[model samples]
Target: MTTTTAFTIAADGSYAARLAGEGDALYAERWTLAGPEAYAVPLPLAQPEEADSEVLPLADGRVLIHRRVAERHAFALLYPTGAETGPSTGELQLGGVEVREGVRVRLLPPCPAGTGAFALAAEDTVTTVWQVTGDPSGPRPVARIPGRCSGGVWLDRAGRLLALDRELEGITKAVAVDLASAGVSPLLQITEDSDDRLLLADPDSGLLLIRSDAPGTARLGWGVLGSSLPVRFPECLARTGEARPFAVQPGQSLMPETCGVALRLPEGDIGLWRPADRQVFRLAAPTGWLGGSGLWSAQGRLHLPYATPEVSCGMVGLDLPVSPPPPVVLESPTPTAPRPVPLQQAPLAGR
Candidate 1:
């Protein structure tokens, strides 16, 4: 019953938080990734958290745990107690967010600034985004978007802008939320009648990995933030069944096409590819992978974290090379070819 968002990495990539335990004894665990050897520290409270509870890592090494109690969602900060406090941990309750009986709430991805955390409270026709931390007063509502929103990706390094897939009138489109101004604008609308989602984004290169049915079927594609170029879906990505992109190499500020992408395939294998290349090289996934939990470095290195019975905490660093560009193929003009359309209607500010 582990929640899908159980594993999360801090915005700075120095720490990770996840729910780890066997059977009925689940607790919060934090991994120190900035050190030479990765290790995990358990932060178990007097009571075990339910399997469905979500944990998010903060830049300061504290974990934000979200639990559902009746019609309210409670929040708490968990940290390891100092040695003087004796081999234990401390939990500071930050209160809770109340919702209607049938509404559901979930934690959003960590903000890029690493100073605050956020979550979404969703109902039938609207979703409320809340800033859960970084304010002395307490958790407060940031924006009330007009749709059933899902999928969260930070579009900038400052964490001021967030992209969400919003479903309205039976159509899903990606939109950007300005946390500073509480404004919403279109981010991705591949077609008038199609579902488009922004799965992952790299702020350094402005590379956006997307999935859309504009090609008649949902397929993986890549687009730039401010560029008017249309999204490109390579045939190679279509060969794989529903590729789930997990990480994109950062620090390629000028070359978004060369950023390495890590994908979790449908067959339980890991695939590495780049927008410049048309091939996906597959690798065997490590055991006990908090599936889809990983980070990429500016130097084209990927770090994947996992925990198993044999090894309590471990990280795998893979230096995946950027694939060589494929040769260009000349094609004859065809009457039935689809037209190239920009994924987004307009370039967002601060891109």
Candidate 2:
């Protein structure tokens, strides 16, 4: 099995990952998401500087990749060749298009209406909407967001682009863009200095989940389209004393799938809240200093990037079961064993 450098889980719960170890060799691996691993198909790009690649699974089973070559970036559509061999080779459906100049592509939403491709964010600062056509090499731009955009989502069932714009006045406003018409319109305008982060939207319900810090603490709020006032979840409270919200995620495994919000407390503890049932879970002080932390993945996974006495820098993954009421702090079932490094004998000692 090849060593994986980075990986992401597909919407279908399968895994599409890239591996690169010594010698800068690159290989793409696809596997099942379920625990017990299965066969893997490896494709070799085989380049010294082949770093930073994104694998986006298409609705039709083909995977779209944005790989960096030389100093430029290109898009490739990869699929099974139906032959059993090394480096599952496939045709290059596209090449030589700059998705976002200077910055790597961050997120790629699924294609919609067979008319538009997807939108890509550069360093989470600049956003550009790309139209993926049958001719892969000819992906054209639909719209370019002017400033830094965050909390992006494809709102409608048709996947219309929706995002929160962080304005110059330090205000975050909800904005929507029509991909077909290239029309940008402001959906909700927030005046408070609180960090108004967009969570998720249910097209069927027209209910937009948002996290806002107004009461000197982060709180869960929900509102529908054309509505300026948001109904705040009175039960959910921020454990963090900083009056800021760090992360907000919608419960996936729950019966109805409620919203879970995490707050970074000043004392370094993390407070998790479920807005639907008004339940709170608290994780004690992190194992180490809390440089930063968040709900890192779409799945129920929390990643804390911190420094330890032994390890200068590392990310610890907390394995907690996903249920109606998720656990706040995860306890490792087995203790991590330490490896000792042998010291070399001194020349003076030998003499």
Candidate 3:
């Protein structure tokens, strides 16, 4: 069966996802949401194995695709040609960092404000962070944190702050890294025993979705950023299908209560998550199709991609309502909120 892999959507609503193509070769397909259409990008010529390659959509409707040669990672910018042949090559740039055998390298997404600033991480013993500013040069090395590093999600659109989970002294802790100062600070908490696993956070929304063991279960946890008082996502999280969040819409980023995640249901449906009210909206898909997370457009439309049992796939453009429809009028089951999880009591005096 043709399985879907990692997917990413551009700011301009272009969608890209990896999937099985002609024969046994894996290829990345680009989608133009307007037509709800999909097509495969050109496969690499030099190293057709597609080793360590990735396709990331750019703001200008093109794609920055990685093509590896001799274990070195290189990139090519592809321009859409709207034909079944393939995307035409536009520009090429070699990655600055060398590929270490076991070390993992990642190209972080740019800030959501379309700031053209992003980060590249080279992970080994110590985490080396590089700030890429679209300069003619390349990614400029910035912070190097000790121990292991992960969960590298941007916290601010300014590219001034980032949130990552790390092990410092053998204890796992989630902390924020200041892009400007390279200083790391531990995120505060609502209780003493709270072990926060920072998932994805939005500074503008002041809303952070995390995983914690507070309620004796490692379920979704959420709270305002600086408030530091994260609460368990209410025992009645009222969700399934393991949704992946999409980009926040413009002008609505600062709204603390709003957010969205594209979920894949077991019965082959696209589930939309607005956790503020524990809402899940399921949109049915064609039979035998599986869908992935999507991108939120400025026009309040969601562009999602789906994979079929065959090599080809499809895209869907979902229009979000400007105003909430009365719950009683809707067909989707209403999400119910249970009583909030009880907070842990403070430690008495001292041990």
Cα RMSD (angstroms) for every candidate in the order listed: 6.6, 15.7, 7.4
What lDDT does each candidate get? Answer: 0.82, 0.48, 0.54
Q: Flag regions of model 2 displaced more than 4 Å.
A: 1-6, 11-23, 33-40, 69-71, 84-87, 99-104, 110-117, 121-127, 133-137, 164-170, 192-195, 217-237, 240-274, 281-351
The ten-residue window of minimal lDDT in model 1 covers: 331-340
Give the TM-score comparing model 3 with the true structure, all chains together. 0.71
What lDDT tens digits, residue by residue, belong to model 3 across residues 232-283?
Answer: 4643243553444444444344444555544455566666555454456678
For the record, the alpha-carbon RMSD of candidate 2 to the native fold, in angstroms, is: 15.7
Candidate 3 local lDDT, residue 347: 29
TM-score of each: 0.91, 0.59, 0.71
Listed per model in order, the count of residue pairs whose N, CA or C atoms clash below 3 Å is 0, 1, 0
Residue 235 displacement (Å), model 2: 6.1
List clashing residue pairs in candidate 1.
none
In terms of TM-score, the best-performing candidate is 1
The list of candidate 1 runs beyond 4 A from truth reads 1-5, 83-85, 326-351
Q: Summing lDDT over every window of 10 consecutive residues in candidate 3, give the lowest-scoring window.
A: 330-339
